[model samples]
Target: MTSALPTRRFGGFLFDMDGTILSSIASAERAWTDWATRQGLDVDAFLPTIHGVQSVETIRRLNLPGIDPVAEAHALTEAEMLDVDDVVPIGGAAEFLAALPADRWAIVTSAPRRLAEVRLKAAGLPLPGVFVTAEDAERSKPAPDGFLLGAKRLGIAPEDCLAFEDAPAGIAAAEAAGMTVVVITETHGHAMDTAHATVTDYRDLAVEWDGASLKLDHRI
Candidate 1:
């Protein structure tokens, strides 16, 4: 009852951090819940729209009285770094990444560089050779800027890249970047039909590198 992963060779890979390669929803939600309460915002109402986008976007949407989004983003990042609870790599995330050459993949995340480092280290994942964070772009996911920036930095054509994502915003962003996307449905619950394909986790996929290109194929 699941969709298949694309079985094509790509010039490079673009990965979204949270909910895709790393499972940090528990820690992220806790941080947001606590932060939301401090700002007198409802946690349940505020957390849903924030995933796959920068915390600054969430803060702006909350529009707290006279609160600066930049400062709030730092505060949230601090809390997340402090929490560290229940953060782990998604299934097969480590293996799939390890199979690729260092230069063949990059991380494009909605998290700030600081928070992204903390989470990646905490989750026992290696940092990408090329990393693009929220700090790299003024516009977040749903805009192509971050993914485009990542591909550019990787020296790979955006259209030749393949993206892996777990949220609708990330899917839109990858598509906007002129890349194809595979939805990792661990968080989005298989609802991301606009993706090229869907899988429950990296466990459902496999990667092969021939030094010149990478091929991602479905395992089952």
Candidate 2:
């Protein structure tokens, strides 16, 4: 049997763009792999664990003894930007976001503004009223800063917001921010136990935002 759909009252919703709203895993993986090959790094071994992290951070995590994190990140970003065509919206994401009240939702992503805009526009997803990009926050996901900043922009408390994330780092970020989290399992194969709930995609869930409260019909 499937897990029950969880519901809660949230003042606003914060979303992670890449894998959560737009399905950019393929493009991201290809870019990273190509960059890794160029760097003489083990593409097959490190690519999966680096997904959802900022390119610079990913390089640092590799701890490649002599690698310059900043330069590598720039290289990867340039490659990924060129690979945007492979990105697209996750199934049902567009309709689901459309059904939500515009002011109550925002995009909180680790992507830099330019790349985020390129991917979102490519996917044809409506831009959220509020957007918190990597440049807007001092720290990225797993740090709660992005989500908290998004909530602050929306004039909502972190605890009063809900976040949709596809990576364990993002789930941890939202949970640390005291917000409810819904994990979408499209990019990562691993399961996250920390999320309030999980869904294969938006098609398996339903949502409605009344002016006073957001009603999530998660039976599916």
Candidate 3:
């Protein structure tokens, strides 16, 4: 009676926060859209492409012609600060994280430390054992720096980890780090075809860790 996929065991789990553990895309979109409107930019055209990228990277990729990227980044940060309450935990996210052994998982996000804390706290999710934020890496997602840092911190090999991501950038990051990736389809659209597996949400999956070996129960 559950929607689960084939399961695999791994040395550790790397998790993405925003759209993966928490349902904050609405808040993010609202913040970005409002900032775009205030700056006389096109929200409809830019918002979709910017999701899942770090704020600074999002600014660069939008290619806003002559706009000040620093100012735009600050504006987006301010907007997100103003709309932090819009964040919520994805269905069954708390239970899913809690079910796993603490040492077996970590959070690797493109969000800066403060923002990542705000969203995770607001969503009432347990903080991971290892948290690698944007400040921890020179390059963000699609670069593997974050995931590599996370695996290093966890004292685990990149190839022995499984990553849960909601964006192609995060998926690419994990893959680049030699980790398996499970994509969540709720936040990011189903446009990516790169994940090891795709799932509707954490609610449809089950996890078990027996000290030495991590086991994922596909029966949910």
Candidate 4:
């Protein structure tokens, strides 16, 4: 017999977009791989580092001579915007999001606003009312700036929010902002190494709000 699942409540919810709510891996990897090839870098080595970080930060890390990271990142976003044909929402993502009260949730992503918007549209997800994107933060994930901004926009304290993420950078960022994290393991091929709670998808999760705080529970 299976054991009963855990339940928790939070004043607000923060979500990381690409991997947690939707799988943009195909479109993202395709665009990044082309960029890496153009830059004469090892595609396999460079691709992994691109996930969960801003394109500007990813480009800056290469330290390639004469390359303007910001300009290149913008160009990359332009390219990504046109390639959302393969983008799709993660299983049960839309339903889970529908259950949450709009004012109590926000999307915090490392992606720039335009890119994030285009991708979400392609995946058929709603545009969140409070979205904290790369331009809204001075620093990217693992720094907590975006997550903190998201909480602030929701009018909730950072520690009172529960964050959902699917990458190490995003998880660390939420934690740094003093929020508990739940890792989404749907797109991962290997086991995630985190002490935070993990779920493969939102299919087994449910949310409820009764004129007060939001409560989330495993539906098993």
Please list the residue runs of candidate 1 whose C-alpha ends up more than 4 Å from where it truly belongs after superposition: 1-3
**Which candidate do you rate higher for lDDT, 3 or 4?**
4
Worst 10 residues of 2 by lDDT: 1-10
lDDT-sorted candidate list, best first = 4, 1, 2, 3
Q: What TM-score, over all chains together, does every model reach?
A: 0.93, 0.91, 0.90, 0.96
- Indicate the residue-level lDDT of 104 in model 4: 92
Give me the displacement of residue 121 in model 3, in angstroms: 1.1
Scored by lDDT, the top model is 4
Model 3 lDDT tens row, 67-133: 7777777767766866777688888789889888888889998887888888888889977879998
Report, for every candidate in turn, its global Cα lDDT versus the true structure.
Answer: 0.86, 0.81, 0.80, 0.90
Q: Per the 3 Å backbone cut-off, how many clashing residue pairs does candidate 3 have?
A: 0
Stretches > 4 Å off in candidate 4: 1-6
Among these predicted structures, which one has the highest TM-score?
4
Error of 1 at 55 (Å): 0.8
Clashing pairs in 2: none
lDDT of 2: 0.81
lDDT of 1 by residue, 1-220 (tens): 1455666789999999999999889898988888778888777878888799898887887767899999888888988888876899988899888888898899999998988998899989999999999888769999999999999998999999999888889889999999988878776643654526777787767777787888887666
Model 2 per-residue lDDT tens digits across residues 2-92:
2555556778878998889888888888888777787788778877777667778878877787789988777777777788777888888
Best first by TM-score, ranked: 4, 1, 2, 3
